[model samples]
Target: MHRRALLAALLCASVPAVALAVPAPPRRVVSLGGSVTEIVYDLGQGGRLVGDDLSSLYPEAATRLPRVGYYRAAPVEGILALRPDLVLASENAGPPQALERLASLGLTVRRVSDAPSVDSLYRRVEQVAEVLGVPQAGETLAARLRAEIDTARAIPAPRHRALLLVNRSGQFQAAGRDTAANALLGLAGQDNALAAQRGYKPLSAEGLAALAPEMIVITSASLQAVGGMAALRASPGVADTPAARAGRIVPMDDLLALGLGPRLALAIRELKKAAQ
Candidate 1:
C-alpha cells in the first residue's frame, strides 16, 4: 500500500464529529473561499453574499459578488466597503491581521476549516450553515453529499499511480500528501504518485521521470498556464513518462479538484475515470 492509502485510512478513522457553531444569521455576508461560497449557496443563503474574496469563483453568482482581494491576502478596506455583517473565511484565509482587524471592527468573522480532507470538507458546510443559522439545512446537505460520496467510493476504480500537476512560474509542482488533490485521488481509488512527500513542490526532470505516474491530472487553469497539452507533454520529464506515451493527461476544473467543495463526489468520479 502507498503512503496516501495509509494516510487516508488514518484520516477517515480519526476524524472526530465536527461541532457546529451557533451565531445569529447575518443579512449581509462575505465569503473568502470557493468552498465556503459554495456551501453558503448550497444552504440557500446566496442572497446574503454581499462580497467575496478573489478565489470564490463558483456557482456563477459568486463571481458577480464584489471582490475583496485574494483569500490569502484579504484587504480590509475592500471588505469593509461592502458593509458585510458576517464574513465566512477559509482557515487558510488572511495574513491573520486582516481577520483580527475585521473582528476588532465588530464584524463577525467565521473561520471555516480548509483542511483538504473529507471531514474538513463536511465541517466547512456545517460551519457555514451554523453561521447562517440553519443547522438543519447543513445536516440535510451533508447527508446528501455523504450518500453521493459513498456511491462514488464504491465505483471500484483502478489503483493507478496518478500525478496532479500545477504550473507555478513555469515549473510543474506535483500534488503530494496533505493536499486537496491527494485526498481526492485517494478517495477516488488512485495512488498518489508523490505520496511520500507533502505539499506541492517543483520537481526536477529526473524527479518527475522517477515518480512514474500512470496518469497525469492537470486543472484547466494550469493547462492554460503551461501553454496546453502539447507543451505540457513536451516538458522535459513528462515526455519520457509512461503517462505521456499513453496519452492519459486529463484536464479538469480547479475548483472541483482542489477546492474540495460541494462537488467532491463529482471530483472523485472524474478522478476515477482518469485512472482508467
Candidate 2:
C-alpha cells in the first residue's frame, strides 16, 4: 500500500503542469511601419491602432491617424505621450535605444520581421494576425495574396533581361539574387541579369556592362533626383548600356516598388505591364 502511494506521488510529480495560453488582445496599438500599418488595417483591427509612422500613407484613411514620426527616426517623446498598450514595429524601425526605452516603460513592443519573399510575407501576415487575435483574417489575406501572386507568375517570361537600380545621390546600386526585387522580378517572369550578387550594392560601369541587362528600372524619386531617365541615360557610364540603347528604362514610385504591403500585388501587375 505504501509502495503504491509512493508510485502515485512519483507519477504526479513527474507529470508537468499545463500552463494556460495567454491571449494577446491589445486595446491600444501603435504601428511603426507603412507595411505594418497596412496589415493592421487589413486585419480589420484598424480601430485598435492608436498611431502610425509617417510613411503609413496608404488606405487614405491611415493618413488621418495620429502620426508617430518616421520609423527609423521615431521621436521617443511622441511615442511615450501616446501611452500605447502595444507597439507593433518592423525590424527596420528604430534607433535601438528608443526601442529599449519603450520596453523599459513597461510597454509591449513586438518587432516584426521584414519578409522579402512571398512565403515569408505570408508568415509575417500570420504573425501579425496572431498578435492581433485574428488569425483567421490573416489566413484569408494570405490566400488572396497567394492567388494574386500565382496569376502574376503565370504571365509569359520577358525575353529581355532587366536591371533594378536603387539610386542614392550619384551612386547607383543594383539588386542581386535572393533580394525582394529579384523575388518580385521572378514572379513577374523577368530575368534579373545581375543575379550573381546576393543583395543590393554599388556596381561599377564595367559591372553593369558585364551584366548587359536589356532594360533598367529606377525609382521615380531617384529618377527625378538624377534629372529623369534622359539624364540617367546621358551619364557617361550608363549611356552605353543596353537599357539606354533600347530606351527601356522605366521609372516607378519608390514606395510602390519597395513597400511590401497589401498593394504589392498592384505593383507586380504594373511591373509586368512595364516589362512588356
- Using all chains and alpha carbons, the TM-scores for the candidates as numbered come to 0.89, 0.80
Candidate 1 shows a clash count of 0
Model 2: lDDT of residue 211: 76
Q: On residues 1-276, what C-alpha lDDT tens digit does candidate 2 reach at each position?
A: 999999999988766543234544898999998888888888899999889988787777888989988998888889988889999988889998999899998989998777677777787788889888889999999889888877766766465688888877678899888777787667667788888778888877777777788878887777888787778899755787887887778887665666666667777777677767
Model 1 off-target regions past 4 Å? 1-24
Give per-residue lDDT, candidate 1, residue 115.
99
Tell me the alpha-carbon RMSD of every candidate. 14.3, 6.2
Clashing pairs in 1: none
Relative to the true structure, how large is the alpha-carbon lDDT of every model?
0.88, 0.80
Cα shift from native, residue 240, model 1 (Å): 1.2
Scored by TM-score, the top model is 1
For lDDT, the strongest prediction is 1
